[model samples]
Target: MIFGSERQQHKILRKNHQMEEGSSHEITSPLLSNKEEELEDEKNEEDVVEIDENENSPIKQVALTVPTTDDPSLPVLTFRMWVLGTLSCVLLSFLNQFFWYRTEPLTITAISAQIAVVPLGQLMAAKITTRTFFRGTRWEFTLNPGPFNVKEHVLITIFANSGAGTVYAIHVVTAVKVFYQKHISFFVSLLVIFTTQVLGFGWAGIFRRYLVEPAAMWWPANLVQVSLFRALHEKEKRTKGSLTRSQFFVVAFLCSFAYYVFPGYLFQMLTSLSWICWIFPHNVLAQQLGSGLYGLGIGAVGLDWSAISSYLGSPLASPWFATANVAAGFVFVMYVLTPLCYWLNVYDAKTFPIFSDDLFKSNGQIYNITEIIDSNFHLDYAAYERQGKLHLSTFFAMTYGVGFAALTATIVHVGLFHGREIWEQSKSSFKEKTMDIHTKLMSRYKQVPEWWFVCILIATIAITIFTCEYYNDQLQLPWWGVLLACGIAIFFTLPIGIITAITNQTPGLNIITEYIIGYIYPGYPVANMCFKVYGYISMTQAITFLQDFKLGHYMKIPPRTMFMAQVVGTFIAGFVYLGTAWWLMETIPDICKDTSSVWTCPSDTVFYDASVIWGLIGPRRIFGDLGTYSKVNWFFLGGAIAPFLVYVAAKAFPQQEWIRLINMPVLIGATGMMPPATTVNYTSWIIAGFFSGFVVYRYRPEWWQRHNYVLSGALDAGLAFMGVLLYLCLGLEDVSINWWGNDLDGCPLAHCPTKKGFAVEGCPIFT
Candidate 1:
């Protein structure tokens, strides 16, 4: 799936050796070359051969980007590193968790901190004293460890990466406290956050042989950071009439910072410019076709970078083939399948808005979720029966079905495509003779004992079982449920890790995990939420840890230092994430409930909706034979068959190279974030991806190779800085600028039901 046979590997090695002898700094693969005829072959060959002769990585990108040597003398765990790394981790954790509740929830990645920490690290190196605490003792340490080095920079970035995203277990805490209106102890919440975050360390340790040490399992996304690191650390020779990478990044960052004020606060309509809705403002059918936020956005586009990269992530970092696959899936689901189902009024679709994440009554009203819950936090079947069956918007329901398809498709797709390669890799992992340059170089350092991970795994599981069993009244999950969740996480980690390693796309287990526990142990929403986090997020955390390990491997940071950095960072991030969320929940009045303010909590809304659907109400009544939409279950079969067909087609048309690129899981799961991600997000993301990944990359490859990833990181940094500034300076004081330009969606009628006599307040009733 990733690399071919031993013969092919030898061939690639020979080709790479030839490439390493050239005179240029650019890296290109014949397999990935586009428009080769337009370029001079001599120049291209020279560019390809610029790799270091000592570099033994089989992946061309790694050979070109990562340095082949390491300086073991560089200090990584210095006092300066600890101070700066801890600050970066804690600050990002607070900022990200704080922003998670906003309407356009901006996730500022570790790239920002990676860039910001450079100057601070250097500043600390320059200013701090080099005085040792204990002159000749074993406990002696210096405050300044000479000049700040790249290894320290890598560790700091790793620390920031730990806190870049909000803790997943917080969703359960927020759902119970804010949405479900129940009390959960702070101590109990802390355990959930800490354990869920650290439980993956064990999985990462167990699988690092196959996932991290191998040269073939090259994680594509890490290349962006690798490129950024080189740009920041290595000296560059500037060409005449062209800016250096850092210069371009600075310019882009300033421009992005200045421009975001319009879309972020002053003129919010630029975030989603639905001009089609403007042309036919009063026509419901037209609005339904064109509304960027609430319907199938036909010609809508977002001018805001946040709107584009917020949900789907930066398109600039993703490969064109992967972007193409996602675009194909988005089009099929959003344009074709969704519209067809709605127009046909499948499952009373016309009674509700075509695109909404909110749970609803059958008659198109918001469901009274609180009414069905008893005082003890369990579902009251009598109250549920009296209130009638719960309903979901047609789009939301279909998205769940698609999620089901994605889970099965991922399993089938990986088995059909990557099974043999994975088996071979697994077998080879045990053979010390097969070690690559990176792994061999790493062997010089003291290896982290496997017992370290084992102890953490055992302690976390014990604490989890104790917490759930002891606090059974609040948590509702049994000790056995905790074990089951861990089993599911352990089972799926390797398969999902393989897909992520090669393709840069990870199929989530959120739906499958929830569905399982909901069927086996239904009614307690807390139990279901807890189960999903352990089963799903733990696997995700493992992949994240492994990804960091690969970055460390490429950067030549010692394995022991990486382990310490990640473990410490995870603990710090977990505490800060929970603390910030708890503070926000207590301080803000009607936080997620408010429709007028920016604190809408779009993601948490979806999380709460899921808790109600799969936990409070249970999946048996929603997706099983007892449900109104039982036929949607056919998607699981469809998902499994589609991948098999793709595999068969690839075998049949061996010469048709394009056939292999039709990734069924990516296509089917394209709109996985639909409830929180709207049409504008996908449309804007695709356009940006095409321009950068296709046009610039194909035509001006040298420029694309250097500036593309830097530009992505710069844009994210600029937008994040401006967004936080806007909120603090203006948003906090409730500053006013009420005008037509501030109307974000401009499609009030998009959410209105088209069915005659289906009355909804604030919408025109058609009789």
Candidate 2:
């Protein structure tokens, strides 16, 4: 008011006129040209954000990150508590492992059940941790425990970290030991996994900005983490009191208990949908039609790892790119690789149209169905022994091809697309917005440098050298072979992880790793298995961790806090995993025989140790199988080169814009090329795509974006909760009562015997 004097009034009037002119210019500018068009688009996007009402407040989002320095307090000894928590996680690991180990053994797919339960654990942990412990500690201002409010950091850590690591640990041990087969010291297996985590985590610290950011490096697995974090920590609407978290806890805990006692498996109800024929009109045609229709419904909703025909649920999962990467990877593998392999006579159509198991008999075919099955039609021992080594040429070629494409893409994409942001944080950049937040936060913190990765490489080299010397009298690996293995693992890790993070599965690496072992170790399984698992799994964990970090980024949880939580979780998980692995191996001997056992260690176990021990270390007579390395599948390996070139060309020129539009060509290729049964899984993808696209794209308001994730988490939790209930009450197999009706085989197995036990070879029930 005092400034309302003549001189002040004149100044205010001039300021108003300037503001009016600026506003007019801004309003009219977008009508001008190309630059203005982009500006208009951006403005429209902002407008869309403004219009959304139900979305969470935009101010609460955070960047994904990892620990740069070890937290002094992270190691605080609740030694007894930590020990018990680790044991609990390990027990959980045993349950998760019990599902798949009976069949595939030593494969990455071992993590599937854990993947399902992860959201449940994360949701519960977030609720309990934020609600109680955080409030008690007064860190609640930032931690914002969502709903459950248990107020115990150690308890939360036990659940979230244990879920992933426990399964991973079991996988690591089974994979490493069985592959080696020579009875490795238990401590050694633990050491390998622990070392991999430490080193991989260190390596991940370098690219925290690239992964955690919104630059659209899709890691949908992290979405739940981000959502939960935001719900709790946001300054406004402080989600500390939400019922959702409590609901998630109630659901997850009840499910966990039910899972402990359930008879069938994690996928029990899923297979049941196929039996809906009993409820339909009773004619044979009607029954067949009814089953098919029910199958379609189940496939659309299926979440287990069965064929596409029976896909009734989804993982409530995704690869960072939604289904696009799945499509692309599938195309490359199915259409390009499968057809090429077949054409080259590397894959005999009669014996194996899909993957070859008996690499020895089927020429260059990578998998053989007859060989894969045991006498009981589960997994065959004779076949495993016959095909212990892979064709070197086939594996290396694929590895080199993927390596070339991934490295090139990584460099070009990072430099051309993200370089400025990396160096100067420039604008006019087109990337996932989250990437920007990741970059900004990293810049603010002191990060682990690229040099650290170099150090890791060096340290790994040193360990390899020492290992070679120790086992040298047995398996003498060449320095070049070691480098090749390391290179393949690191390079392939990015694409495989990216592909899986987006697509859910990428079988490409299985071939690549297999062949590489054949080339280096030949008939020996020991060294081959070790190298492949360390390389592949380490890379895998790195990407998965990155995806997890991205989730934390979105929720505005302090990067440091997330890092601490992960470390605590990882350590707990490691110990727990070890115990579970030991127990499962001891208790389930029939399931984990070296050959043809249903839970025969991890898949890569034989491959790794066989390569290193027999081929590399063992004398010719001592390990007669060593000579097999010379039988490289040259043409198969060569085949991958073309795709590598194609990918590079696309990156360099990108002439066919429409090509990019067909993002998940591989997914279609997979659906088409795999057995017709796989169609069910393909169907599930369409369903997931519809839901995710609808929630994230069609509904683009801030509120929609913020809350939809929570909703998705809720749905997953609810279904999982129901699954628990069905398992508890109805039972499965012959373990308990069958309340839902008596069939154990939900959907019939691939070659299951008839109800009268005459049609097929073995039992229908899996592990």
> For every candidate structure, what is the RMSD over all alpha carbons to the true structure, in angstroms?
7.4, 13.0
User: Residue 517 of model 1: what lDDT?
Assistant: 96
Winning candidate number (lDDT): 1
Clash count, candidate 2 = 100
On residues 267-385, what C-alpha lDDT tens digit does candidate 1 reach at each position? Answer: 99999999988999888888988999999999999999999988777888777787899999999899888889998999989989999998888888999999999998988999989
Candidate 2 overall lDDT versus native: 0.40
Q: How many clashes show up per model?
A: 1, 100
- Predicted candidate 2 versus true structure: per-residue lDDT over 627-683, tens digit per residue: 343222343333344345445666877876644433332332233222212333454
Q: How does candidate 2 fare on TM-score?
A: 0.58
Worst 10 residues of 1 by lDDT: 42-51
TM per model?
Answer: 0.92, 0.58
Off by over 4 Å in 1: 1-58, 433-436
